[model samples]
Target: MVENALGDANSVFSSKRAALRVLVNHGEKDGLTAARMILTGIPLDETYLQNRLSIPMNDEKKSLKGGRIHIPDSYYLMGTADPTGILKSDEVCIILSFWYMHQ
Candidate 1:
């Protein structure tokens, strides 16, 4: 009985360690993807932003600040010269700002 209990505990610990490793690997991959997107001046999709970055979009629970002329329902960033851009600036700066601030 003691041997069986020890084996079960070892199995559970190994399983949890493997799961943590997978999560860490995924996080590294996602970080690389975000960096590439920023460097290439590509706009991030809503799914990636919300799901991976954990930025809420179009949430009714959040209240908007008063006296704002233009209120965006979702966050956005685009390169300069794009008139329709929400956050108009270089992609690297915008993405880095979000990444650091979110942490």
Candidate 2:
């Protein structure tokens, strides 16, 4: 009975470890994809994007702030705030998304 219990526990641990490995790898891929979309999908120039954006905090930190764009008389674009700088417009909203390694 003891041997069987030990074997079962080991098997469960191995399975869980495999599942976690898969999740970590998927998170890395997702982070890269989000980073790409943010860089190319936005209308902003490459240089501007680099200066305005911060690097991923970790492999799981990949995110895209605004995928939706609004067009109008004045035009609305996605932007983040810099505490030390000024915002050209009076209207500013903040949004955040957290990417998890698992699910």
Candidate 3:
């Protein structure tokens, strides 16, 4: 990750594992705090992400022609604001608190 005098501006490009660590750690401390951080931190370019990873960025439930499993709301999507200050429909993240067992 690249760093500047201002700070780690390249955090948006950090690996998924690193991002997950931050998310999980913060979540452990506080769910709302973690959710707020993720809401403000993740800087994904919707078009680029869609074209590169073939992942939808919205909370829709429509099925993709190739597969019904590809419904827009099938997975937790990341969201962000547009230039006009409107929240993008596709940029969303789900936060849940629950227990899990490691195998």
Candidate 4:
């Protein structure tokens, strides 16, 4: 569904290929947060870190504000393990958080 959505030229998400790939590779929640961060061009900060790359649960169940793409829970699980052994979940999160902070 996500791959198909990305192919639509008229879709708001059409240009967000990289972020979508991250979404597919990772999971919807983190992927969406990363995509928003990319779109907003906002540097990671204490506030964002405190929030932990997640849309608030109440807000998440409904549609995302501003008509952003929302991946339903049925499409993916709450958590995903990395297929490759290159990094553990904590390590990956730490690296991403660090990279985002430094940027």
Candidate 5:
């Protein structure tokens, strides 16, 4: 199993169900540094990853394709966004939160 420079714990890069992850370089954290790995659950090295960055997903069923099990809109009881620009990487970690849709 390959280790993460910052990838997921169970990401082995060889799993049949492994999904894609896009690590976008962002701001810093605790003076160490931080990046946003958009998609999650896949362990790929720099060389392997760099070659496929931003390769947009073109699947119809996002949940099935992206390792994200769909949450019915009816299940979305309520939510809140601070909107104060106070969220940080540590303060909030997005493990496959957003997804892109095309028409």
Candidate 6:
């Protein structure tokens, strides 16, 4: 019984770990999370590598007084405090997008 329990636990752990790995590598976004980021002053930089914006807190240590999104494709950076910074506007509002296509 003990051995069987251990095996089951291991199996569950492995699956969870695998899922995490995929999420980390590919990047996953939720609308709510993205909205929070925007509200917190973190702009969305979608034009990242592999259409995936994995912003691992560029300025993690710093409490975000304000943040900007650097969209490499348009070469325009958007700041929440300063909406005028955006050269092009996206249809989605404050989208925390995981997948960004690179042309």
Q: Return the top candidate by lDDT.
A: 4
What is the C-alpha lDDT profile of model 1 across 1-103, one tens digit per residue? 3343323223322343322222333346664554454346544443553243221111111212222122223354565454556544643344446575464
Model 6 per-residue lDDT tens digits across residues 13-101: 23433223323332336423433444465433433321222232222112122443222234333546435665445533354444554
Model 2 lDDT at residue 89: 62
TM-score of each: 0.21, 0.16, 0.20, 0.23, 0.19, 0.17
Question: Once model 3 is optimally superposed onto the true structure by TM-score, how far is the C-alpha of residue 44 displaced, in angstroms?
Answer: 5.1
Give each prediction's root-mean-square deviation over alpha carbons.
Answer: 19.9, 19.6, 18.2, 16.2, 15.5, 18.3
Where model 3 places Cα greater than 4 Å from the true spot, the runs are 1-12, 28-103
Instruction: Evaluate model 2: give its lDDT.
Output: 0.36
Top-down TM-score ranking = 4, 1, 3, 5, 6, 2
Scanning candidate 5 in windows of ten residues, the lowest lDDT window is 25-34
Q: For model 5, what is the alpha-carbon lDDT of residue 42?
A: 34
* lDDT, candidate 2, 12-102, per-residue tens: 2234332232233334554444345453564323554333222222221222122221122233346756675665566565553335212
Per residue, candidate 5 scores C-alpha lDDT tens digits across 1-103 of 1223123223323321232321221112311111223244333455544334323112213324445433323222233565677886357533433552110
**Highest TM-score against the true fold, candidate:** 4
lDDT against the true structure, per candidate, is: 0.36, 0.36, 0.33, 0.42, 0.31, 0.33
Model 2 clashing residue pairs (backbone): none
Query: By summed lDDT, which 10 consecutive residues of candidate 6 come out lowest?
Result: 56-65
Which regions of candidate 4 fall more than 4 Å away from where they truly are? 1-24, 49-103
For candidate 1, what is the TM-score?
Answer: 0.21
Better of 3 and 5 by TM-score: 3
lDDT of 4 by residue, 13-87 (tens): 224443344344344566566656656765444365224333332233233333545454323224457677787
* TM-score-superior candidate, 2 or 4: 4
